[model samples]
Target chain A: MKIGLFIPCYIDAFYPKTGIATLELLEKLGQEVEYPMDQTCCGQPMANSGCNRDAKETEALFIRNFSKYDVIVSPSGSCVHHIRDNFDAIEQTDEVRHVRKNTYELVEFIHDVLKVREFPWAEFPHKVGMHNSCATLRALRTASMSELGEPFFSKPKTLLSAVKGISFAAPKRPDECCGFGGTYSVTEEAVSARMGLDKVTDHHDAGAEYIVSADTSCMMHQQGCAERNGVPIRFIHIAEILNGARS
Target chain B: MSNKPVPHAKLAAEFLKDEPHRHFHDERLWDMRQKRDEQMHIMPEWQELREQASRLKEHTLAHLPQYLEQFEENARRNGIHVHWARDGAEHNRIVEKILRDHGHSSIIKSKSMITDECEMREYLEPKGISVTETDLGERIQQLDNQLPSHVVVPAVQKLTSDVAKTFAKYYNTDPNIDDPHALAEAQRNAARPVLLSGDTGMTGGNFLVAETGSFVVCTNEGNADLSANLPNLHIATLGIERLVPRMADLGVFIRLLSRSALGSPITQYTTHFRKPKKGGEMHVILVDNGRSERLGMDDFWTSLKCIRCGACMNTCPVYRRSGGQSYGSVYSGPIGAIIDPTFNAKKFSTLPFASTMNGSCTNVCPVKIDIHDQLYKWRRVLAERHEIPFVKREIMKMAGRLLAQPTMYRLAISGTEVALKTMPRFVLYNYLNPWGKHRELPHPVKETFHSWYKKNRLNKAKQHEETQA
Candidate 1:
């Protein structure tokens, strides 16, 4: 299958490795991959900020870049969700609808499309706790890291729990945002940092060595607080762990 | 203190600067969550009840005009005078007229976000009638002359020391001593005379049961009960969307509301006033104030299903940390983020952007309003109406172009990695990047998947095809 890679703008600019890993992982599963260079963003940052007016140009740009791909895959659940929810704005053309329908978050892409039963790489022995990214958990409806079930049917906690070396520690406030809500971090910095710190503390109190989640944006925020506060915990995106490359 | 409206970023910074207070507040919210979870675990049918309540709300909202008419008729039949207000100003004017007609210059009120929306105190005080908030938290905020920070907690943002200082200043006591209990005593002493002098009491309704022509008010502080019972003229202000089809619905609602809000099985008072006592007159003001228009919009109609449980608020990470003040509205957190826009989009356009769409609010909500989903919908609505910033619009346009194609996406990924690796950190930390303010950007990797995939998967697929050929 020819899979179009959707690299979210932030990942494109900063965390390109996530995009690269997503490409390699799909190929390792024997799926043909294509990169659409025109792809810049999922319009999430603008849309989430109550600036969909700003998203129009990006929405048009997204449609123009990835319209031809048979299957669209991105590492970020939040971005994929933005596309799924907002593609109608760009154009309700059947082609746009097809791209939106085919676009999948990496885990859902791997689990459902590829149906991989075993990790190709070896598993690490360390115990890892997972944080469910709000968009992926709520929007994409990814499996919960804390429970076991169908990945797409339940919250992302379930899906995170399925990864090897991953043991789920229930959040004190389950399913709460870690407060790294894109622009919210800057606009509401004090509250955002405090929320991120609270989530970090919760993970630390749970005796987690590493906090894994699907969204890099949230991990970035949580990891910053941990690093700044000299907290011992580490953060990794679920894609990095799921790719099993570190092992 | 500036005459200009306080930007959310500045407000958050001020809140964050008080590290000790933020810590205490977060800790208290966490404790509340623990208590709520424990309570939820005891009831196996809790999730079911949530579904039922949600369905009931959905049904009521779908046929809102009918239910509203039904509510008006029942309330009128019960000897309660009913009035409708088209908007905030109208609501305030109608309320003021009623108070004036009843010869009430002073009123005791429970916490009501509706009043907050209408700026009722600002309206009433200017008219020479004093409106005293009776809920402990509301009273505290009222005394301090600040908005209630959180919907349920109201005073969650204020530390006990802050409360003590405010009380000391008000009662002419020493500010040096900071004791919450003493401060509570002081407030109680100070408020008693005001309560006695109050002629009318007002409270926000939790649910206005259409069948009984009555409404239920829930509160932990017993303020609503006291304010209602003590005052000769009792008035309840409720949004038109607050109605339930039957009185039996209260059993489901009352059971879930407190548990979801604060983890209590029920609040200290869950008073249901169907009719006024013989000497007293009970009045119900069914305020539209933009709800009927919101009900007309399909995307946001679910927001009307909110029980105001504050479970969504309690579980909201943004709300828990930021407190309620940052949303710049009476409602804060997930539910507030969505609903606030419906009530006042221009004022609260930034609310939806205030948090990551963590599904916690949706999951924790007893009535299950799909708050995060509504936030997403509101983004589209806000965007369609040109509510978002200009810079964000251009960036999204650039992104939408790049994401739709596979080849460009690959080129962009490879190019971005090389740039980030060679570029200075400050370049990535520019003002345009919100993440740059507080987060370290993740380092890009050496090779992208396209290069690795072409070398591995495509080659292997070619070999398999060649073999087949």
Candidate 2:
């Protein structure tokens, strides 16, 4: 399968290793991948800030960058969700519409499309908790599907559970946003920090050594909180773990 | 009085300073939500019911004018005099006129956010008509002569001791009373004399069904029932958007509403009054109060779909921690953030930017109003009107300019990382960095992914293209 890699601006700038892990994991699964260099952003930063007018140029840039690929995939659920949900409104060009239809988040892409039943490598022996990002769980309707279907094929937790030696513990409230919304962290800084602290506390209280999630943005925020508090709990992106990277 | 509007952030900061025993409240509410969701999930039809309720609300909103007319006609036929008010002042005047006509000096009111928004108490108290708020939470805030911090849970910010102090000051009760239930009973006892002597009882309607010429008011404490039923004259104020097409539609809303708001299967009392019982007078006031104008505007019409369950408030992270008072509106939390700006645009314009649009409110809404989306839309509208703070506008504009260009974005990211890493932590923790107050900035990674990807992936791709050629 030819997969077009969509590097979200945040991933491109801050955490390139997540992108590398995604690419390596996909390749190891015997999937062909193409990285579009010109793909700067999914226009989320602008669109989410209520600046869709400013996003127009970036939207066109997005369409131009990855229109031809059959399956466009991104490591971050939030970025993929932004494109799938909001791209149509950013001038519904045929290419943009096609990209929206074809795009998938990494976990959904791997589990749904590839049907990978198990991880290629053994996972580290530690208790892990999964924090669902808001965009992925709510916007993509991943939570609904997880509730309905089989363990392997349906839920993200089930998919994460397949990693050998990794025991997944449920959160006090499943699927709550960690409140690290783009620009929200800055604009409503105090509230965002409190929310992040609460989420980290939940994971810490769960006896989980590591908190895993699909979106690095949320992980980064939570990780910042953990580091600042000098808590030993570690944050890992699901893609990094799925790709068999151990901390 | 301070000229400046109540500083919600400062008030919240003060409240959090002590870190009062809010854990029990949070834990209890969270537990209730979990149980509610479990019950809701037991019935596979819950999602369908939500959809049905959403559609019903949409239909009602689409033909609001006709349904409202029908409601008015039915209400009049049932011996309930119907009045229309264009705005808050007119609504208050018409309400006061009714009181004046009856020669009533005092009236008992249940928790009506609409009335509060209209400054009804402020207006009526001056007219020598004592409006006693009957809801336990509202009554507590009333005793303190403070605006309700929350729409549903009026005194959500107040600890039991706060209520005890307010009760002790106002009703000369024991300040030592720390038990919530005891304090509530004391509040009820204080309100009892006022309720009995009051000539008219006023309550807010959750919905007005045009088909039955009836309105429904839901409450857990039965305050609305007591307020409306006990008095000789009962007055109900309903926003124009509150109308539904038929009585049956209430079933769907009632099921979704309580579940969403307080996480109950249903509120204790869901009273529907078609008309006055026996000989008692019933008056229905259909208040436009800027709603009809809001419905005309496409971007905001969806806000009218709200059932005012306050579910959004419960789940909102910003609201949960900061409390409703932080929003500085009669309506607080997510729904309030949207509704307040619509009613008083200039005064509450900063509300939309007060929190992150986490989209949890949208997810948990019983009526399924895309609240976070509307919040984003409101931000756009506010920005267009230059309602956003000047600093925010400048920052956004600069971000827009930088983010528009890939090179600039890449350069800016690298530059920021370099600057942050080299600079001392306190240097970056200045007032300008609002995040610095509570959150420590994450250390910048030495190498950004863009550079790594360019070196390892993009370069390889170019070399492969050359090799293929």
Candidate 3:
């Protein structure tokens, strides 16, 4: 089966290691992965800002690029969520429907589709707090949220537990948002920063040396908050740890 | 209506400037959310109860007119005067006429958001009538001359010290008093006399039951009952959407209301008012006030199902960090973001954008209002109507054109590495960039993934193909 890797714009420019880790992790699991270089973005910034008309051409471009693959996977949960749910800018052709249906966030893809149990090469001895982006937590139904009193189940934790020597930090408010909402960080800068600071502080206070997540946008904002406030915590992508990064 | 958007972002920024207030507000509401979750944990049928309440509300909303007419008929037969108000002005007018006809010039009222929405006090104060808020938090807000920042806890945004000062100004209490109980005692002492001497009393209806022509008011303070019973004249105002087809449906709603609101199993007072007391007159004003028009709105009608439990406010991260007064509406937070625009679209346009669309409000809603989804829809509606700001619309359009073309998008963002290296942090991301005000920008990378892929993977694939050929 063909796998199309979707590296979002910020990931492509700033956090290339995360994109590299996702690709390498997929390949290490004996999957054929291809990064379509012409991909720019998923039009989330436009559509989220309530400009669906402006999002049309970008969404069309995305559909044109990813329609041929058996499944399209992205390292960012928010982008994948937009592709699956809110990518309604253009016409709903067969290609659009196909692209939307086959799109998956990398963690869910590995946890559900690949169903890989053990990462023999992956190990991290440091204590890290898991950050679930709102898209992954609520929109994607990835894990049992604290809001819904269902039996506790976490797909990301299920996949991460396979790694050896990894310790977890239990924060006070584990499932709260980190406030890296695309464009929301800039638009509502004060509250967004306050929330990000509060999130990293919670993890740090709970003895977490690092915060890990499947979505890099949240980590990027969180790292910014930590560094600015001298919070003394680090950030990493879940793909990096699952792909056996030792740091 | 004013076309200017409420300065939500600006006001929230100002609210954040007060570190003490911001932390207290966030932690206080977050504690309520935790308590709510604890309640959910005990009730195995919490989700099922929420579903039942949502279905009941939707059914009532679907046949709102018939239920309202039925309620009016039953209420009239029960010796209660039923009045219909098409708008806030008419509601205020009807209220004024009722008070004037009864020769009453003063009213001691409980916390009713509907009266606040109608600006009833603002309208009546000019005409020699007095309005006193009887609920403690609401009384503090009235004394301070500020809007109730929260739906359930009107003075939750104020610190205890702030309350002491406000009370000291009005009730001659000690400004140095730090105890909440003492403050409550002070308010009680001041309110008891006003309750007795007031010529009229007013209460807001929590649920209006059509089957028995009775309305329910749930309060922890029992102030609603005092406001309704102390005076010979009683006035209860409620939105028309509060109707339920039968008294049995109250079982579903009453169970969810306080549990979802304060995480308590039940309110201290759940008074049911069926008819007038002996020789006392009772008036029920069914206020439409744009609810019928909102009911016709396809994307927004479900917002009418809200029971004013304030669960959405407690769970909303944005509303917690940004004080509710920042919303500049009587109804604030997630519910307000959707409902306020129906009142005045241009005035509350920025309200829908105040959220991150995290969808927590939808989960915590007892009646299951799709609050975040409605907020998104409101944004699209506002933008379509040209209610959004000019610069934001233009920037989105520019971004759309640039991002659709891959080459152009690459060209636009490719300079960021150089810009990051040359520009100082403040110069690059400070005044011009709202992101730099409180957070550091991401560090510059030596090689972006695009360049690395082309250099390594693309070249390796070409080399393998050439060798094979």
Candidate 4:
């Protein structure tokens, strides 16, 4: 299958390790992957701020670049969510429709599509608390969220537990948003920062050494807030954890 | 109303100065949401209940004119006077005229948010008609001369000590008393005299039952029933959208209402008022107050489906952290974020942007109002109207251009890297930097993913394809 790697702009710029891990892990699973250099973003930042006119060009650029791939995958949920749910302006051609339907965030592709039960090369000896980034939790329907009380299971937690030597401590409020919220982190920084701080405090209280999530956008916001407030916790991407290889 | 409006972002930051209090406030409401989830688990058909309630609300709103007219006709037939007010001022005037006609010296109210929307206390109190709020939370806020920050838990943000002090100062209850039950009983005793002796009683309707021409009001405190039962004149202020087509529909709403609002299976007082007491008057005033105009704007028309159960506010993370007062609207939280912009864009413009668009409010909504989506829509509408900050418009324009073209995006990254590497903290974390005020920027890496991909991954994959060909 032809797989396209769609790198969200912030991930491409700030956390290249997540994109690299995504690339390496997919190849380890023996899937053909292509990195489209021209693909920058899903036009979320502009469209979310109500700049539809401004997002149009990026939207067009995205369509022109990655429309041919049988499957397009990104390490971020928020970007994919914007394309599937909020692309109201795009002409709904077969190609545009195909991209929307075929595109998946990395974890959903792994949990729902790959359905892997074991990771022969992965090992993470750490107490990890998972952050259910809001876009991924609610928008992508990746798992039965803690908010909706069912026999509870998580897609990220399922996959992460496959790795050897990793323990999971679910936060007190497992599904409460980390509050990175794209531009909201900066626009409503006070509430946004407080939310991040509280979230980290939950994980810390649960005795997590590191916090991991699928969307680096959230990791970026919370990680920055943790560092600023001296919260004594670290953040990482799910891709990096899944790509973990032991000697 | 005329001064410069401080946007939600700035006000939220100001509120966060007291971070310890903010965390405590969040946990208290979050516990209610957690309890709501516990209640949902006991009933296996929780999602189904939500869907049926949503559909019923949608059906009622779609055929609102018919249900409303039927409700009015049925209400009048049952010896209940039905009055329609086009707006808030009109609604207040109608209530005042009712007071005038009856020669009522005082009125007792039981948690009517519509009256707050009408600014009724300010209107009636100055006119020599004293209005005492009967709901305990409302009574506290009334004594404090403050708007109820939350709709369901009017004083949800207030600490127990604050209520104890209020009770102590106002009613001469134990000033040092801190036990919740003791303080509550003291206030309840104080409110009993005022409520029983009042000439008129006013309350808000939760649902207007079209089939029976009766209205439903739910409360845990039993204040509405007490006020409605004791007074010679009982008035209900209902927004036109508060209608259920059939009495049978009550089961779905009754199950979902308090569970969503307070995490309880049902409110203590889910009283249905179909008619007046013997030799007394029952009046139901139907207030539109821009709700009809909202029905015309199809994009936002679904907002009328709100049940005002306050579940959206309870589950809202932003509202949890920012508190209700920061919203600067009669209604606060996610619902206000959407509804405020619809009513007055220029004044409440920041409310729409207050959300992180995390979309939790949409999940918890009993009527499934699509609140976060509406908030997004409101932002676009305001941006189109040029109601957002000029800096945001300018930055979005530049970022849009940079993101559209890969080369420009890359070039801008270079400059951003340079700025991140070199700029002083004064510039990055200064008053002008909204994000920088509270959050430190994640420093950009030297080599971007595109650079790494181009150097190693892209060409190798292309060469493999070439060999395949």
Candidate 5:
């Protein structure tokens, strides 16, 4: 399958290592992956801020860049979520529909579409807490949320379990938002930062050496919180771990 | 009202300044959320109950006029007087008239959020009518002259010391008294005389059963029962959306209400008011207040399905972290963020944006109100109506334009990188930087993915293409 790699603007700039990991991981799985250099973002920031009309140009450009690929994958769950769910600012043409239907977050792409379980090259000895972005947990249904009282299942955890020497740290509220809600982190910085501090502290107190998540957006905010609050914790994207980054 | 939006973020920042209070508030609500999950875990059919409750609410709302008429007719047969209120002003007027017609000078009411919405106390106080709150939490809030923050636990955000201070001011209790039981006793002592002296009683209806022409009031403290039966004149005011088709349907709600609200099996008192006691007059006022207009909203109509169980608020991380008072409305938290907009779009515009849109509120809602989704939709509605701040809108416009063109986006990214690398610490972290106010900025990177791809994969792919050609 031809996979179009969507490097969200933040990943493209601040967290290039995550983007690199995603590309390498896909390549290692023996799938054809293409990074369309023209792609910048999935238009989540504009659309999520209630400026859908403002999002139209970016969203259209997104379709223009990735229309021909069989599937579009991003390391950011929120960006993929925006494309799959809220990418409605532009007209619903066949190309738009095709991109929306085929776009997948990196974890879901590897777990559900590719169905690749074992990561032979990946081994993480550190105890890590899994942070599922709200978009990945609730919107994408990648895992069973605690609120639903359903049988417990986690796609991210499932994939991580397959890795050698990987143990999970259980935070009290594992799936609570890390408060890096695109524009929300700045707009409501006090509450947003407090949530991020609490989130990092929760994992830290649970004895986690590092926090792993599928979305770089959340980890960016959380790393800032951890560093500022003097919380002794580290952060990594799921792609980095799955692609066997030694820590 | 000034057209200025409520500064929820500012108020929340203020709330967070008191670390102990903030910690207590977050933990207390989180405990309720956990208990609610425990209740759900035991009930094997919890999701099914939510579906039934949601469908029943939607059905009744669809035929609201018919159910309302049926309720009015049957309630009259049960010796109840019914009144219709088109808005908050009308609802207050109806209540005031009921009190004045009976020559009543005082009313002892239960914890009714509808009365708060109608501003009944503010309206009636100048008319020489006194209202006393019988619920412990509400009485604390009433004595403190503050709005009820959480719908279920009105004083959940208040510490024991705060209550002691408030009671000391009014009930002549010691300000240093730290025991909650003693504070409750103080309130009970002070309110008993007022509860006994009041000539009229008022309670909020939790459910208005159309089939039986009766209403149910669920309270942990049995305050509603006392408020309804203490005087010869009883008034039950409820929002129009509280109707259930039959008594059987009431069981579904009753089973879900306390479990969702407080994680208890049921409230201490789930009293059914089918009729007035002999020689006592009974009145039921159905208040629309903006509910009819809200019902007409395409994306927001399902919000009426809210039973006000407050599960959404308890489960909401934003609501838990930011104290409920920060929302600056009678209804606060996830439910309030959606409902408050219906009252005044401009004044409460900031409420919708107060959420992180985490979707926990929607998951925890007993009736499945889709609260977080409504918050998301409300932002779109407000933006289209120009209710959002001009600066934010303009910024988004610029961001959209910058992101649409890859060339400009790359330029801006590199520009940001250079600025971050070269800018002074004072310049980077200043009053204007909300992100830097509490958190550090992401570290500057040497090469972005775009640059890395160009150097590594893009060149290789180009070379391969040439070789194949």
Candidate 6:
């Protein structure tokens, strides 16, 4: 019943509403929650760039702040994936084991743990297309990606369908990357921008008024590209929509 | 312009400028990727085959030395000449020597990326040896004096009209014949005489069977068969990692290779050459060329298991848009991102950063190379060696510092919105900020979530404590 909220650095700094929405949604589902303010990030940017030494400091810090909670939840599947799957540099003590074992992304937590089919408080009246972040879809296994022959299911979509006045837009390459890719958006700027434009353009062509995703890092990247290129579409974090941001 | 040695980011940026061409290039490769998915779906055991192929490759790599020796001994007994090349220079020298010893002036080639990697044509052509690339795509690229943009479909980036012009220039055909079939026919007709008269033939093998001392070369066009069969002197080049333990094991790779390569049920010609024709010499050269050194790199050893099918390239969003030429390496796309960095960090350091680390390359790989994971690991290795671009490296270091201390991060970023709103776009979107060049920065939130949570949740907790007391 008690949960610790893990706000990834991007959500905390770039999009505070997402963190607030995550908190509100968890509370509305009748769970006791605590926000560990000392928790800054999951050390993915460092670890992914091959800077193990840099990642170790944050890795140890993450375990220190979130080790006590029976279950830790984050709005970003990628950050949770970084903590659970890629914290090899940190010593594998009991606390590290507990932190890695219990962390969950928001959709998976709601769909699998909360197991609540009804969301009486949630309402969104827009045609939205889902952008499956690589970390969330492929890394966290939050959904069945189009690549595999596995029976198709999406933890995020299941919850979205339960929300009132929401319709889904199905794009041609629905599962392709938005290409934010953390530092890649800047480092490989042109390809990254082209990828983001392609993804946002696809959703817009599919008639989505807004593109929604589980990872705000992707949302930020796609939204930025959409706005700059004058693409007539908006991006919303799944948490914001689930929290009834429109209201 | 020769795309002068530049970072992949810059090269990709320039490549994306031809917006219409880039979109055409993107859709052309994506269609292949979609077709590959169709093939993958038909086979219910596609995932199982990938696992089996990956495990087989891993076992072969782990026991590679023993397998190589067994292959050499068995190949020699089968009357196939075996050559060991320590590097690209050696591989090229050996190929030249074979042509010289056999008195061959013209050589015909079947789609061998290894030869491209060794720059064999560049080495051989200047010395009066005519090297003809028989694969239609490579031949088109060869005539145009261009490198292949995609390995499997070497000229896939080109349109039918582009090939029509290239054919007209080289073969004296009508440039007006823009139909795909007409252009292909012209190229094929021009190739027939060259295919028959060439005194030497060369190919890149898909798999080497150490058990039977046989090698398999799969191609849909049957060009490998023509080049391989017509010449009295035949040469097959392969990376040392191409060896498989047994001939029977070819089943798993064959099942995955064509389906993953072009989504074909099977290649038109899957030729197994255990022995050459009477009085003809068939030489199989095993080229190391940094592959042996890569096997020692624990973080990247699995990368050597690549089958050169180009499946990863087809599926890579970055590669599809940027084109393989942007990679500035023979290997491009996700596989190139991993393999290039392992060989020369200073030269290929930017390659690993080219990917978004989406892991789609990992899923589609028939050999299960775990390509995206390797890209991540390569980035870390580059930073350890201080090979990351200087400014980016320092920025990452600073980020690590700020991220470890939440209060400082909160203080620094919470009020970032005011700067975004007031700051001129030119100042923020200049050359210094790569993200700002073609994309806008995300508008910042009013305050950090920590500040909001403290005021809202922490205050409520305190009020509840007072009420309970």
Q: Looking at model 3 chain A, which ten-residue stretch has the lowest summed lDDT?
A: A175-184
Q: By DockQ, who's the top model here?
A: 5
Flag regions of model 5 displaced more than 4 Å.
Answer: B463-469
Candidate 3 stretches with Cα past 4 Å from truth are: B1-3
Backbone clash count, each prediction separately: 49, 0, 0, 0, 0, 3
Alpha-carbon interface RMSD for all candidates, in angstroms: 4.4, 2.9, 0.8, 1.4, 0.7, 1.5
> lDDT per residue, candidate 1, B122-165, as tens digits?
88798898888877898888887888787788999888778778
Output the worst ten-in-a-row residue range by lDDT, candidate 6 chain B.
B1-10
Steric clash count of candidate 1: 49
Whole-structure CA lDDT of model 1: 0.74
lDDT score at residue B39, model 4, on the 0-100 scale: 89
Residues A1-247 of candidate 2: C-alpha lDDT, one tens digit per residue: 5788987876766677788888888888898888876567777776676656667777787788788889998989888878887654366867877889999998888778888878858476778888778887767756552222212323577677788788866667655667688887776676677678888888888888999888888888888777767767887778788788776
Candidate 4 residue B77 C-alpha distance from true site, Å: 1.7
Q: What DockQ does each listed candidate score?
A: 0.39, 0.47, 0.85, 0.74, 0.88, 0.74
lDDT string for model 4 (B1-469, tens) is 4335546776766767775667677988898888888888898999899999989988988899999999999999999999999998999999999999999969988998889988888998989999999898888888988877888888877778888898989889887887999987897888899887999999999999998999999988888888998998999999999999999999999999899988899999889899999999999999998998999897899888888888889898999998877887678999988887766788888888888898889988888888888988888988899988899899899877887898877887778777888889898778877666666788858888888888787678689999999
Model 5 C-alpha lDDT per residue in residues B1-469, reported as the tens digit of each score:
4567899999999999998999999999999989999999999989999999999999999999999999999999999999999988999999899887888889999999999999999999999999989999998888888889999999888899999898888878899996988987887888788778889999998999999999999888876787889899999999999999899998899989999998999999889999999999999999999999899999999999999999999988888988878888899999999999999999999999998889999999989988888999999999999999999999999999998998888888899899889999889999999999888899999999999999899898799999999
List lDDT for all candidates, in order: 0.74, 0.78, 0.92, 0.86, 0.92, 0.86
**Candidate 1: stretches off by over 4 Å:** A1-74, A83-86, A90-99, A109-115, A145-174, A182-194, A235-247, B1-6, B398-433, B444-469
How well does model 3 score by local distance difference test?
Answer: 0.92
Q: What DockQ does candidate 2 score?
A: 0.47
Chain A vs native chain A, TM-score per candidate: 0.88, 0.92, 0.99, 0.97, 0.99, 0.97
Better of 3 and 4 by lDDT: 3
The estimated TM-scores of all candidates read 0.86, 0.92, 0.99, 0.95, 0.99, 0.95
Error of 3 at B18 (Å): 1.5
Using DockQ as the measure, name the better of candidate 4 and candidate 5: 5
Instruction: Show pairs that collide, candidate 2.
Output: none
Name the weakest run of 10 consecutive residues (lDDT summed) in model 5 chain A. Answer: A39-48
Query: Candidate 2 or 3, higher DockQ?
Result: 3
